[model samples]
Each structure stands twice: as structure tokens, then as C-alpha cells.
Target chain A: MSTKHTIAVLVNDQPGVLQRVSGLFGRRGFNIESITVGQSEEAGLSRMVIVTTGDETTLEQVEKQLYKLIDVIKVINLSSKPMVARELALIKVKAEPSARPEIMGVVETFRASVVDIGTANMMVQVVGDTVKIDAMIELLKPYGIQELSRTGVTAMIRGNA
Target chain B: MSAQTPEVRSTEQLREKWLKPEVITGSEILLRSLLLEGVECVFGYPGGAVLYIYDAMYGFEDFNHVLTRHEQGAIHAADGYARASGKVGVCIATSGPGATNLVTGIATAYMDSVPLVVITGNVATTLIGTDAFQEADITGITMPITKHSYLVRDVKDLPRVIHEAFHIASTGRKGPVLIDVPKDVSAATTLFQPDDRIQLRGYNPRTVPNKLQLDKLARAIEEAERPMILAGGGVIYSGAHEGLYEFVNKSGIPITTTLLGLGAFPSGHDLWTGMPGMHGTYTSNHGIQQSDLLINIGARFDDRVTGKLDGFAPHAKIVHIDIDPAEIGKNVPTDIPIVGDVKTVLEMLNPIVPYAAKADAWRDQISKWKAEYPFRYVDSETVLKPQWVIEMLNDTTKGEAIVTTDVGQHQMWAAQYYKFNQPRSWITSGGLGTMGFGFPSAIGAQMAHPDRLVISINGDGGMQMCSQELAICAINNIPVKIVVINNQVLGMVRQWQELIYDNRYSHIDLAGSPDFVKLAEAYGVKGLRATTKEEAQRAWAEALETPGPVLVEFVVEKGENVYPMVTQGSTIDQMLMGDA
Candidate 1:
């Protein structure tokens, strides 16, 4: 019965606002799959894109509960309609001289870029949907990924109409 | 004159500062804000962190300030005052232990939707986060419990924060709001620019119900054969009882109430069918089970009311109305949800709906059930019962007393036995079910209505929770009749253990509990004890006649259980009615 939902919340950019939003989720026991916050188009507001997994009831409750918070201004379920979602990841993988060519081929195929190359290690940066970044990570796993860091999903609805 | 009196100095200062804004300390600003809001009384305890706030109240005779024995009593008293007075009650406490002590009481008020403005003094702003003495993150701690909270760092923001706290607390859904003022802020002086304007972009509450939803509800009411009205605390809170009365009488729909909704509809009305859900009347519960349309006003369908979500009102198309949108469909599925003020919505609906003579059969069936299963208890010459105590109080006061109750069997009995005909007459910790809420809140209710008789019903275990409040009651001459149902145990939990836990009673016993009679006398209040039913009646009579506060310990049936109970996960129709 549970499904993933991406909610875009616009909130006042005040001190302790992030903690208030995150703390609300923590107390309500709503598991956050992924969340990212950044400045919005408005001057005094920030947009938070949160990916959460829940059933229909949970989704409704989550949205209603978020509206109860003082700092929260607006909430939109981007995943409910046509929307664009993306995530970025930088993966550091072990690349030998011989393995570099194959790694470059994988990067080119995935449309990812090799940001930096060292003697024994190289970093690949990928920016796309979560599935795309996940696929690239899976490919780099066999080449021995040393470290990986991911910026969680951020989304907005399509066709402002 | 060597020194000008306060009145003279104030007059001179006003003349001198006529051209400019008056400057005052944050503590003074807070007090002035309360006065502007027409606050009459404040309950608090002074501490090291709140010395400045206390100093501001010293000999300041503009309003009354009650110095309670503990912070918990202070908060509950404020909550009680709010409920009975139908005005926002204010409370003050210092930081750390003082602030933490108010947590339970604050949560109690929040749960029951009592409007309260709670003020707490924190350690100096500079000393905050340094583990300073008597310091606490009260704003952070109470965030979940309170409707809103503020930790004021700047002195200039005091007026706005206090004003906003009151506005937010008293409006919309009505809940407690805390303002944690740092010691430095309270002591620091600033030019007072009082702004009554509330322009919070994200904090507006919707009061006008959507016409579409109202029309849908109207249509449902006209079409449905078995329509019923389930009123909640919001009816009393919004002062919509008169309108609700009109709606019920106009539509010819039978009405039931939640515990907090006991006083919203007159108990003696022909259309009234007692409370609904767990421990409610068989007529209301079974009637809800069969109703085709359930029109709920102001009451959230809490699990206690709904029992099993899947089994609750399976046949009914619910029309949920509340001021808070989050509560509409939070628990049970709502067919027609109207988010608005109950009073406003009822006014809008009164003229639109026609008389429903179709529900005559449904009403007749409910009346039959009510007659068949009345709230009855067996009488004994030797044994005293809690229900009898409540019934006697109802008779003795002619149901004119404002009844507040502590959580447990006695509270349920009070809700069941006491017949309230007026709104705001029944105040209890229904949401939080706080044990120590009764006595202090009774103090508050008595303070609000000096002419009305106020009775605080408590169990043995809960009596000890905040019995220290007796000092204030005696000193202030609150005249609250404190009824202690001394079965010498936690009756509700013990009953649950007896039924659900195979009689393996945990530490529900209160054998070492103090003799409540001596305890009251120690605090300079009258005390009485009753071991037999006759003695209880006599003691009740004496207490009612006595001048000041009275604590009557009525020894009740030890192993008794409140029947008509719908256990957890059970449907309302499936009640455990123990053999009478």
C-alpha cells in the first residue's frame, strides 16, 4: 500500500527553520527517503524537496501535518503530477592505466564526466535522476569505488500552467 | 513630597513622554501586553531565572497573580481558568526544572484545545547553550506540545512575540503557546512599540467554512434516513451550543457528545442521547453503529471514539466539521469535510436545512435503547461507590456546579453521572488525561466564577498528584469542593489489569497514600472522611454547607469497574457491560 512521494515545501528562510521541518518529520515517524533544501525564487523563502515513502493516508497526513508547522508556507506533491526530479553524485573509484579507458567508456555511455584523474584514483561526477545516478554507481562498483557522496533528490512540477 | 507615589509618577511620566514612545523593560512589556489582551489573572511560581518577572508583579495591583505551590499546578490552573472563563489563561514559570515541570500540564491544555499563554524565564541570553544554571531549551522542548513557541533573544521583540503568542493561542483551534524570555531580555529595557497587527504570512487560520462542503452536508442531511449529530468540545469552545441546539431541534436529529462535549448540549433534551464511543451510553454507541449519516462537529474521530478504524461507522457517510484542517481526516475517512469555525458554520447551516421527520424511527429506536440501558449502579447500605458520589453531587448542586475531574474512573463517572446544562460547565484533561489536573483546575474555575459552586472529582491516586494546591485554595478562599474517591488504588489501570492482564496487578495500589482528611486540615482547609454510603452522603452535605474549601474523602468500592466500555480495537457496539 505504500508508495514513494516527492513533496516540494516552500518555507520561510529563518534560523532553526530546517530543524523545525526535519524535527516535525522525525516526531511524526514519517521516514524521509531523501531531502534537499536550497534558496527559492522568493527572497525570504526557501524550497525543500523531500522524498518520502508512505501510503495514501500517510501522504495526506504528512502534508496536513507540515501545514501545521509555523514556518511552512506551502506544500506541493510534485510526484503526484508531471514533474522533473534529479540527484547528483560524485564517486571516487580506483582506476589503473589499463582500466581508465574502460572507465571512460562507461562514463561516456552514461553521459557522465570524469572530473579529476589521479595516479591510482579518479572521480566521476554524474547529475541526473536518482535511477541514472544509481545505475552509474552500480557500474563503478565493479571498478572499486573508494568513496561516494550524493545530493538527494530535488524536484519541481512541469508546465507551470 | 519626598518621593512621588506611583500614581503621581505615572501621571508625570505620561505627560513628559506624551511626544515620544514610552520605554520599558521586557518584563513590563510582557505584563502590559497581557493587560492589553484583558488578562485578569496569572498563575506562576518565582525562581532565580524569573526574578525580574516576579519583581514586575510585586505590588502591581492591575491584575491578580496566583503563586502556586508548584509549576505543574500553575499550568493546569491556567488551563482550567481558560476552559471555565472562556478566555485565554496566562501562566509564568522559570527555566530548567520550572519549565520542565510545566511540560505535562502544557501538553494537557494543548491536547484539550485550551487557549493558554505560558511564559517562562530562561537563563541570560549570553549564558544560553553554556549549560548555565537553571537554563533550558523550553522553546525547543515544548515545540511539539505547544501550538507555537518563541525563544525571545532581543528585548524589542517582546511585545510582538507576546501579542502573537496570545493571538495564536486564542484563535483558530485554540491551544497553549509558550514564550520563553531570556533573563537578559526580561531585565533589558527598550522603547515599547506596541504593534497589535498580526501579519504572519504562514499562520492564518481559516474560519469561514467552504460553501460547497456545507451544501454537500446539507444535501446529505436532507437525503439520509438515519442522520445523527456527534458534537465535540468545539461546540462549547466556539459558543455554538445555542446554534447547535437550533440545528438539532430544527433538523430533528438526535445528538450525542464526547466527554469534553458533555456540557455543549443539554443532557435533559429529548434529542440528546448521552455521550458516544468508549464507556459511553449504549444508546449513543449502538445508535452510531446503525446510523447512515454521522455529522461530527468540532470533535476529531480519535481512536477512543472510533474504536477499530475499520469497524467504526462502516455504514455512515461522515460529515466532519472542525476549525483545524489537519483533524478532519486524520483518524477516520471523512466524506464531506468542512474546515471552519463551528459557530460560524452552524449559523450558515441553520437557515438552509429543512426538518427531517424521516429520522423519527431512528430516534425512537435510540430512545428505547436509552431506557433499556441506563447508567445504573447497585445500592448498598454499607458500601460506598464512586458513581453514587457523583450522582449525589449532581442532585445536591442541582447540576449547577462546574465540575472538573482528574483522569481515571472517577472522571468517567463524573462525565456519566453529572448532568451539565450549560456550556463550559465540564472541564477535564480529556486529551492528555492528566491525573493531577482536577484540583488546580478547580481552583482556576472557582477563580473564574466566584459565585458558582466548583467541584473537583479525583481518585485516590490522583488526589496525591497535586494535593499541595490546597494551600492556595485555603489562602485564596477558592471554595472548591474537593471530592476524593478513595478506593486506595489506581482504579482504571487496576480494572484494566483485572480484565486484560489476567489480574496480575502491577503497582496500582496506593496503600501508603496520606490520609486526605488530615492532609487538608494541615493546609488549613476543612476535611471529612466517609467509610459508608450514609457517611458519604452526610459528609457531602456538610462539605456543601461549609464556608471555605472542603476535602471529603469518600471510601468507595475498591474492585469496581466502569462498564459500557468498548475495549481497544473493538467496535462501539461490542461493549463490555459487566454484570450489574
Candidate 2:
């Protein structure tokens, strides 16, 4: 029953902190499956979003464990919140000139973008839920997919401040 | 009135009563609540923004903290904890890098369906989104991996969010949850209400199995002859071992557990065929291949389980019972789909399926196959076989222990040798094939079953991935026994390489490693070295007697592979055992 969960952590911008955090997870043999770091709305502080999964008691332990780390200021379980989660994918498909229009029709239906176009290949960008992305891939398979890439899922809580 | 003169209270007492509020930092309150709720420990890293939480932790001596090498490790530790304990694991990371590091661990946990709560600190409330120094769009980064997520802009939301995270993590399908807190929120002043109350639409999880679905499932079971039971991690999650056991016993159908479902069916049970899939037992392989009806309970048809999808159980009618509706037809097509917890599903279906007492002929056929290809090690002549170590541990522990395993040959060896007589006694990373899962999983398992002996059967290669975890055990006094099968190579991959690529051993060999005994000493934990059968037995005996965390390093011969292995690109019948 080892399922992964995503977590967003807020901390001070400093050195040796990332090591400390990741080390804690590894040291516990907790799988820090994936993590993304970037600028937050707050100045001086950084936001780290993580995805991991465990049981309720274990996660409660993790929350308490995280509070003990000196560099970590606050922690959030974004998955338990009422929020919106999404991911982006860039897929390149090959189509004959004659079938180009048909491909465009499907793209328009999903509100996707034709980011790049070549004589025989078209690169389209789509952003939505994972299911939507998967559906798009399945639809484009008939048209011949050349290459595909995805920016893993990201999320934001719903409602205004 | 004159005798009883009214006395004025001291200024300090009046000030304490009238002005001094019962003060506690948000982080400390959070930690205290978690401890009160039976969270004895947590895993995480520290940062500037989260300094307040660390300070708050100083006051609560009841809670133990294991500082990970990274935030990702903290999340992973929580994952391991949750997996082993059957409860939501918790971790904390600072903003930016700290929070970001938790992403991979969270995603891993999400895919595996482990319940976890991750907490991160952000900058003060007023300075949000100013292109802050350590700030990042964490909520945005974690969307796909979590069941749900939360960002708390105010202090009042902490208790509710935490409560919700715990509930969601333990309930339903179970996955990870996150909460982002601004720095000021941790320090903000607010009335302390320890009561956790939260109400949300579209968030209710089913606690009881749907009866209609159960009826349909019973109908499916009643019609089958050559039936197969496919068990998954969900059975463990639902704690439905008794119900599942009763149903399987009454039906007299052989059980084939998945990698995640290993311990769901007691290994020692006569009806327990074995694991099914690429590396599954010949009995399980044949059972799945020949079955006319497949009853999949709480298990997904992972590629390893359904190799060469077109050829997998082509004639079987699959009846899939799961809590997640999305999983019904996601992997393999289903003839009948029942969505609910396995425990409830089995309970309701237990009565409907009449006691068709004895399938003596079918049971005899299965027993014949089981005898022909019992899960046994052919190469017992080696100097130090990992399988023997696992067998000895199993014997010594008497099936009353909780065992966690890291990925690779050692894991499979443990699975094959260890007799898990009870449910929830074995924990590992089945979905992700994640390495380094054992040490921390044992830590969490030990916490959950304080009196039970917890053992981490680890491979040299996998253990090296997070050897630092030993330090956490040492510092926190979590007395998990670590049995490292020092094969000096990545045994599973090495086996694959030998079997397929002509045995040109590449980077898989590890001729050099730190002295494990010294390594344990450095971590302030006890160490035992074993090379022979006697040494191993003696070491294990000593380990059992030890009071604190101990590492027993067995210098097993290199290139010792798990046998009775079904080679890749071959049918289940075409197995490659020792000397074959």
C-alpha cells in the first residue's frame, strides 16, 4: 500500500537546507519521489512542492517530522485541499498534407495550440488534467505521433484570497 | 464580613488571568496535536523560513524527529512510514528547494497509493508573490500527484487542513496530501481550539462496500470453474485479511498475490499458490494462464503481471473489484467491475456465494503443480546465500515480525523465504520498484508495532541508496534490525544481464564499500557481521537480544541470484531454475 503523495513545503532561501530536507526523507527511507522548487509569492522564502504517498499515521508523522527540521518554516498537504491540479504536454505528430486539416480539427476541439509546424510534422501544446492529456495522446495516435514530452502535473488551490 | 477580609490577587496573577493568553506557536501546536494523535516521529529537513517550526519543536520533547539528507528523503521516509504502518506518514520541508525536493517522493507515494502529509513553510503573508527569494509555485507543481492539496494563508486553517490531510490520507484509495504555510502563519496569534472539524463536499469516502456491486461479484464467482484470485495492496489497506481468507477458503480457489499483494495471502497457507507475473512462481504462472475466471481484488494488472498483454490470460473472464473506479478498465478489460473497498466487497459477497464446499479435483490439480514446482532454492551450496539468511530470519522471528524489503533480488528472496503468517506484516515499494525502501519502512513499521520485532531485509545495492537512514534510526532509538545481503552487486539486474546480455558484468559490480560494521558504529548503532550459517544464526540471535537499532551485514557471495525465476520474454512454464 505504498502510494505516492505530493506536498508543498515553504522554507527560507539558504544553503545546506535542500540537502537536509532530502536527506531526512532518504534517511527515513521515505521515497521523495518528485520535487519542484521555484519562486513563491512570498519574498525571501522559497516554496518547494513535493509529491509522495503514505498512510494517515505515517503522513501525520511526516508533518511532525518536518516541523522539527530547522530550515523548514511551514508545510502544506495540498492534495487534501480543495484545489485545481494540471499538467502540460508537448506532442509532435506526423500527418500527410491531405490529413492536416483533420488533425487541426481535433486540436481545436481540445483548445490545444499548434506551437510548431513542419512539412510533415506538427508540434502541439496541450495543458489540462492528466486524463485529458492521455485522451489527446490516444486520439493523435491514429495520425502518427513522432515524439512526446510532458511537464509533470502541478496544482493550485481554488478560490480567491 | 470583617473576619473574612477580601484579599486582592497579585498583579502578576491578575495579568496572567486577564491579559496573558495561553500562547503556543502554530507549528508547536501542530506538532503537539500530531503527537497527541499518536504520531511519535516525523521525517524532514530545516530551512530559514521554517526556523520557527524547528524552534516550536524544541518545546515538545515527546515527538522525535529524523533529519533526512534531503527534503525528498523526508517525503520518501514518510512514504516508507505510511507503507509499513498503514497510516498517513508526515514530513516537513522548507520553502523553494526544500518543498521542491519533496516532489519526487510525493509522486512516488502517489503512484503507489501511500498516504502521507507534507508540510512546507513560505515567506510572510504580506510578501507573497513578490518574486520571493526561496518561494516557488509548490501547489502548482504538485497538482497531478496528490488526491488534493491546500495552501493556508491564515493560521486558523492549520488545524482543519491537518485534520483533513490525515483523514484523506487514511481513507478511500489513500494518497499523499500537502499544506503550504506562510512564515507569519506559523507565528500568528489565534485562539487555540484543539478540536479538528472539517466538512467538504465531494470529499466523502466510502467506508462500506456497495451491496449491489458485491451481489454482481458473487454472481461472477458462482459461475466460474477454474478460478484465480488476484490480490493487491488494497486488501492490505482495507485490513480485510479475515474476510478475504474466509472467502478464498470456502471457494477452494488458489490465490496468486501481486508484488504489492505478497503478504495478503499468508505465505504458509496451503492454498497460497505464490506471486504471479514475470518473476512469479510456476504454480502462480500456470494458475493465471489456465484459469477460466480471474477475480482481481484490489490489484492492478501492471505490465510485470501481464507480460505480452495480448497473450495474458486470453481466455479468462476478468472480474475486477477495486475501490477506484478509474482502475476498472485502465489496465485490463473487465467483464464485471465492482468499485468499493476490498473488505466490504468480500464481506457482502461472502454470504451470497453459496458454500460450494469442495473443489477436490481442481484442488488436487493445483497441489500436483505446487509439488512439481515448489518455491525452493536449488543452489544451497553457496558460501552465503541470501535466501538462507531470509529463511533463518523467518524461522527466528516465528512469523510474528514485521518485515520491510528494498527493491531487487533481496526483496524477492525475502518474499520467497519469509513466511508472513499475518496480514500487514510485510511492506515494500511494489508499484515503483523503488530502491532504498526498507530501512525507513522498517522505522515506520517499528513505530506502528512497538512490541513486534521489525526487520529490514535489504540488498547491498538498494541499501547503499540511502545508507544514511541508519543514522536516523540511531538518533531516534528506533530499534529496527537491518539485514543487509551483501551480494556486492545489483543482483536482479545482474541476473538479467547474465541471462540476456551474455554476463558481461558492467557497472553492476560493487567491489568497494565501507566496512559495514564501522559504518554502523559511525552512526552510533550496533553492527554484526556474518559470513557463514553459524555466524548468521549467532548474529541474528544477538540482533534479537539487542535493545537498539542494529545492522547485521552478511557478506554473501557475489552474483547470488534468486532462482526459480521466470525469465523475461518467456512463458511462465519456461522457468530458469538453478543449473538450468
| Tens digits of per-residue lDDT for model 2, B1-580 | 0123435666466334423335666775567556545675788888977988888876444556778776755776777677767777889999888889888778878777888888888878787779688988676677556666777877776767777778777788888888887889888867656645655533545556667766666665566677788888889888888888998887777898887787787787888888877777888878888887788989878877876666778778888888776566766778887878889888888877754334456667788998998767644554877878888898888877888888899888887778776777888787777787777677767766767888988888878777887877887688899988998888888988897889887788777878888888999999999889888889999999999999999988676777776665565655676752
Q: Per-residue CA lDDT of candidate 1, range B1-580, in tens?
A: 0122454345345433432457888888888778777788999999988999889888786678898999999999999999999999999999999999999999999899999999999999899999999888898888889998888999998888888988899999999999998999999998987768887887888999999888888888888888888999999999999999999988999899999899999999988989888899888988788899999999988777878888888789999999999998888889999999999999999989777767778878878888899887776777887888888899989999999999999998999999999999999998889999999999999889989899999998888999999999988888999999989899999999999999999999898999899999999999999988788889999999998899999998898899889988799999988787
- Cα RMSD for candidates in order: 3.0, 13.4
Pairs in steric clash, model 1: none
TM-score, chain B, model 1, is 0.96
Going through the candidates in order, their DockQ values are: 0.70, 0.03
Comparing to the true complex, what docking class would candidate 1 get? medium
Residue B454 of model 2 has an lDDT of 88
Writing each residue's lDDT as its tens digit, candidate 2 over A28-94 gives 5566656667677888677777767787555655664565443477788877877676778999999
Q: Which stretches of candidate 2 lie over 4 Å from their true place?
A: A1-161, B1-25, B32-38, B68-73, B125-131, B193-195, B207-210, B356-358, B380-382, B567-574, B578-580
TM-score of 1: 0.96
Backbone clashes under 3 angstroms, per model: 0, 147
Q: Evaluate model 1 with DockQ and give the value.
A: 0.70
TM-score, every prediction: 0.96, 0.73
